[model samples]
Target chain A: MSAPPLPRTSAEPLVPVLAIVGVGLIGGSFAAAVRQSGLVTRIVGAGRQGGTLARAQALGLIDEIVSLQQAAQTADLILIAAPVGATTEILATLQPSLRPETIVTDAGSTKADVVTAARQVLGDQVGQFIPGHPIAGAEATGPEAADAQLFQGRSVVLTPLAENSNASKALLTRLWEACGARVVCMEPDTHDTVLASVSHVPHLLSSIYMWQVATAQDSDLRMALAGTGFRDFTRISAGSAEVWRDIFLSNRPAVLAELQEVKAALARAEQALIDGDGAALEDFLERAALARRLWGSRSGLA
Target chain B: MSAPPLPRTSAEPLVPVLAIVGVGLIGGSFAAAVRQSGLVTRIVGAGRQGGTLARAQALGLIDEIVSLQQAAQTADLILIAAPVGATTEILATLQPSLRPETIVTDAGSTKADVVTAARQVLGDQVGQFIPGHPIAGAEATGPEAADAQLFQGRSVVLTPLAENSNASKALLTRLWEACGARVVCMEPDTHDTVLASVSHVPHLLSSIYMWQVATAQDSDLRMALAGTGFRDFTRISAGSAEVWRDIFLSNRPAVLAELQEVKAALARAEQALIDGDGAALEDFLERAALARRLWGSRSGLA
Candidate 1:
């Protein structure tokens, strides 16, 4: 179900020097897990000018914080875990210092945009850039929230370009597996479309709904009356604004397309209510209830 | 703060006999809590012809399973926790046997429709019926999911009729307080409108999104890739289908009104994406993120 098993020999680290850019939740957690697995000799973290990189170092999530160029020069593997919007700039910065053998991967939510950015900047060196997305996230952020078990039993999607060699793909796949993730391969466009339907659109719609309710005239009263359901439904809206903003913009095409479908679905529901069609309404709700219940049971998230 | 501090006297049970019309999550929890509080001598349950009433009795949440008429004839208070669609029929059955002093209340999600149904069926006895919406819920249902502390530290909103005496209002307030819930009062229309903004619309929208995705051509792939955000956002869709169906229909006007506003918000977001207006998109998301984070922190739900 996953890539070939990690090619390991006795007592050898999988990565000699690992570099993580944007040491936030995903990056920090990857460092923690890989370190815990004893699969990396050293972890260097680079992030936007802030205490996050220092915090990651302090929390033992990384060996040190360095400049992007320094990280690229010294690293055997560089993982860009920043927001998708910053991908092109980060790639451009890394291109000059990047060694031919140093493989690069990312943890962005959108794949196609990141792939395009990598191709535009890396050019002939793009073969070393393998795109990835960890299908794991939480509302929490920063180094403090990173856990060694963050990616345990989770799926990590790798959308490798045609230029990539099997060895480069296998290395990243092995790294993700070492962090306890199941690696799956997908086409970049399909990955973007699928993720847009399930993740990007849900995030945007949740934020839209939250914004509407929070800015309404009776917002105070409405907030006071909201309960567990409202809390859970809007929980994702509390995520990092810059990160999600980048996601929605990067995956705009698929997201806008799915939003049309969601709008159509809402219109049908509204029509059922306006027509007072109890049978139609009940049938609709029942289908949703059944599907949701089945998924919850199967996913163990009920 | 909570109805004259429960109007208590030392060592005396607040209610002698309590009747729960539907032995589901809300009603069964209420029975369990009141029984544990020693505020009731007996708890009788009546539900749609099924194993639910018997199951509630077996779980010690109810002392007996009886007909609605029997419950009306003997109980000091009757709580109709059935779906709103069943409220009228249940009220009609209880009206003939309802004692003048037997106060009636409900745990429906919508208040205005429940109020109208009570007025239609209970007629002159409408004074006995108090409309309420509990600001607590879980995806689980039935007696098995009932917890005595389900309402603890939760808000229970009551929309009292003009016909209701101070004594009747005070009794329901005291009952909810005994179950560790803070009781608040609102006009029937106001309660419906507020809940429409927070709870009802979210549930309907979540269900519609879930339904659309679950029925899509690549639903299996989408579901496979979905993570925690999707789970939390759509958890409410797994609720009782009949219950939510009735909630949407019963609260049609308010839900429809809220849906219009939600559509407008979504349209704005769609336009922002189309124009690639990063500033506008980020601004919209930032506002929602701020509001959601504030609410989550203040509500201790973060």
Candidate 2:
């Protein structure tokens, strides 16, 4: 049985100044939840768009807007919540201003790239960085879509750097716990492969299927006839294009591998249909239906 | 703006006797809805399993259990809600017993085959048959899973035969409208092609994706980390294997045609990923996202 979410604790904040970079859905939601829990004294948000950063502050997702360097200098903990492709540059800019005792973590969906970025930019201060990917979010984006309960009953995976200590890992774990997330620790590469099969490839395939149907000659008629099942099956394709594009590029190898596997499976299914092999096709669908039926309960998503 | 669901016209019934061929999700729900609308004096259910039929009667989904011939002799309206492949045989047996004026309709997912079966089995009385596909269902099946409101606000597509009179079409349309469905009439081939693109291919793709993920060595870990989006995207894959197999096999040509279209799109997306062409990938995803975002509002599913 699963344990209860959120442990009892005092009202003391986790860090004096918590800085968030790229204040979009992930960063904004993290700020809202941590701020609601009073686990940080101030949330300083930094982003490429000055307007978006200011709006994040106005929405109370952040206490102020600042430059990446300024945030690195003042904050005790820095959260990089940018897309995976931008993390390398963000970490590079923040490296020069970081103090040795300060902790840094990121919320990118693809983690191996973030680890490589840390290795290149943070220099010897890489020990302070803990790479993570929160298994949460919807197709919606921005500060306006932020919710304090976004991470409740969700899992956050942390992939600590070789330079990290046990105390730093504990501190980061506690921080996520305060936000009501069940934290798991795994190697960055393992996280990438697992997520490729479970999330990234699914997103790509859904988008691909949607593109196939949407650009077809009878798309208007097809769309009219589509019901809730079709809607649910392809809803993830509506996610932010830039974010998904980055994920596809950053996690290309694993995504490509899984796509090949699916292509092979679909070929067999198509052949079974052409051959009029009802028994063979039923066998194929049987395995999937049984597996998927058993998945909902064990899959925390339910 | 749409009007309220059911009219408050009369305690009078719509049909004196309504017969359901298979007392499952679609047929049982039809029984419940029409009965609640006070639109049927007697509901007769016929299936292979006497035990299941008894349960349906206990649940009030049917007022009596009868043989197909008996139902044909008495019921003014006979609803063939069995699986698609079985409908041909069912219609053949019911034809000899069916009264000349009796109206016969079906609730199959695939229609071209049903139209052909009606043409072959019901002979000159084929004019009484209306081939239909209700764009509503849940992951659940069986009589116990039936709901009176299943068809409310949903679309019901009817593909009538050339022999069908205006009166026959109007009667089927009115019966569905009274059950709160928005009815649309089109050619049988048009219905099959639209459904092949919208429903059949999505179900097949989802099952293949699930099979791909579940058969992997790291399936346990992948399932653990999967989120609600994954669940919703793959939910249809959990539907009955026999039902889906019949759908794929019965609608092979159109399903294969659509699958080829999807394969081409997937290959294109994969190429963009391999080329690291962010702009191309973004363009591909942008079209899908825009189409899907707009689909929910126009789609009855939303």
Model number with the top TM-score: 1
After superposition on all C-alphas, the RMSD of every candidate to the true structure, in Å, is: 1.4, 3.0
TM-score of each: 0.98, 0.96
Report how far off residue A240 is in candidate 1 (Å). Answer: 1.0
lDDT of 1 by residue, A1-302 (tens): 23456647626887899999999899999999998877799999997856898888989999988999999999999999999999899999999999999999999999998998999999999999999999999988888999888898788999999998887788888888888888989999999999999898889989999999999999999998889999989999988889998998898899999989998998898899999999988888889989999998887556
Q: What is the C-alpha lDDT of each candidate?
A: 0.90, 0.86
Give the clashing residue pairs of candidate 1, or none.
none
* lDDT score of residue B56 within candidate 1: 87
List chain A TM-scores, every candidate, in order.
0.97, 0.95
Q: B1-302, model 2: which lDDT tens digit per residue?
A: 12234334557665889999999889999899888777678999997779879989999999999999999999989998888888998998898999987889999999888888788888888998888888988888889999999999989998877887776677667777778888988888888888998899999989999998999988999988998678878999988898888888888888998888888888888898899999999999999998888887677564
**Candidate 2: which stretches are off by over 4 Å?**
A1-8, B1-9
- Which one is best on DockQ? 1
